[model samples]
Target: IAQRAMEPWAGLMRSFRAHRDHVWCKLSGMVTEAGWRHWKSQDLQPYVDAVLSIFGPSRCLFGSDWPVCLVAADYQSVKRALDDCLSGLTEEERSQILGASAIEAYRLPL
Candidate 1:
């Protein structure tokens, strides 16, 4: 089974969906994972859409990788890129992805 039963991402999505009770996903670090020099937000849209579809807004959160991301993009660029990817969602969904989900995931006092 380990030889060819699963593609890495396919396996990951399956596992993620199966473990929804405790697992949540963070959409971040994309800039570092991409081309870095000339990558565009559009380049990340598909992956973002995939994560959102599988996890839904409630179980997905946004993260800014901060100083580590500076190697590939500035802080503002990273944020703007995620905002662009999230542009098509409803306001409530965007709010969930942007902030609400994090609060819930972390059980923050806010």
Candidate 2:
């Protein structure tokens, strides 16, 4: 049998559901070529909601990409980019995205 074609959405959902093995969602490069350029400034609520729909909230994470983010916005601007999207989520979810998810995923000592 031949290999399956790359379906980005299906693939992403599959990875997200594998949360039993891996927790946390870094939405850094998830958008399209054009979309990535605009993602930082645009309302990312839909995409954030989509991830919540598939993976729930506890597994989400935030990353600035610092250097990569510079392609779209300044370091501080990109670093603060997720503030709006995250406003709708619960405190627990925010905790995960801010640090808990990374701590768990990397098995880091906190």
Candidate 3:
């Protein structure tokens, strides 16, 4: 599905038109997909990159699935994993993925 969505002829962008106002969480389900016991940032980078490419920094938010993530890694470890995957992004783009996008997406009063 990720590959299909990334294809130019798949009309993924057109599908996104209906969700133009929505933001996408680049986190979630990664640890499980990568394998709970033997996951690394490198293992998850392809999936993360795909999402970032499709959604761009402005519409992509980071999510720390907390207790769920704990089953695979510690809180800091999970965060560091994502940080590693996002290492090449600019500071502003990182900020968007880390927090700014979530604020906008959720319409928070902060």
Number of the predicted model whose lDDT against the real structure is largest: 1
Task: Enumerate residue pairs that collide in model 1.
Answer: none
For residues 8-46, write the lDDT of model 2, one tens digit per residue: 765677675875545456756332322545554345555
* lDDT for residue 10 in candidate 2, whole number 0-100: 53
Per-candidate local distance difference test: 0.83, 0.61, 0.75
Candidate order by TM-score, decreasing, is 1, 3, 2
Model 3 stretches astray by more than 4 angstroms: 1-21
RMSD of each predicted structure: 4.7, 6.0, 4.0
Quote the positional error of residue 57 for candidate 3 in Å. 0.8
Candidate 1 overall Cα lDDT vs. reference? 0.83
**Clashes in model 3: which pairs?**
none
What does candidate 3 score in Cα RMSD to the true structure?
4.0
lDDT for position 38 in model 1: 76
For residues 1-110, what per-residue lDDT tens digits would candidate 1 score against the true structure?
A: 11222357756896868866788889988888778787889888877887888888888899989889998899999999999999999999999989999998899996
**lDDT of each residue in 20-45, candidate 3, tens digit only:** 75546556656754577778888878
Error in Å for residue 42 of model 3: 0.1
Q: Candidate 1: which stretches are off by over 4 Å?
A: 1-7
Q: Is candidate 2 or candidate 3 better by TM-score?
A: 3
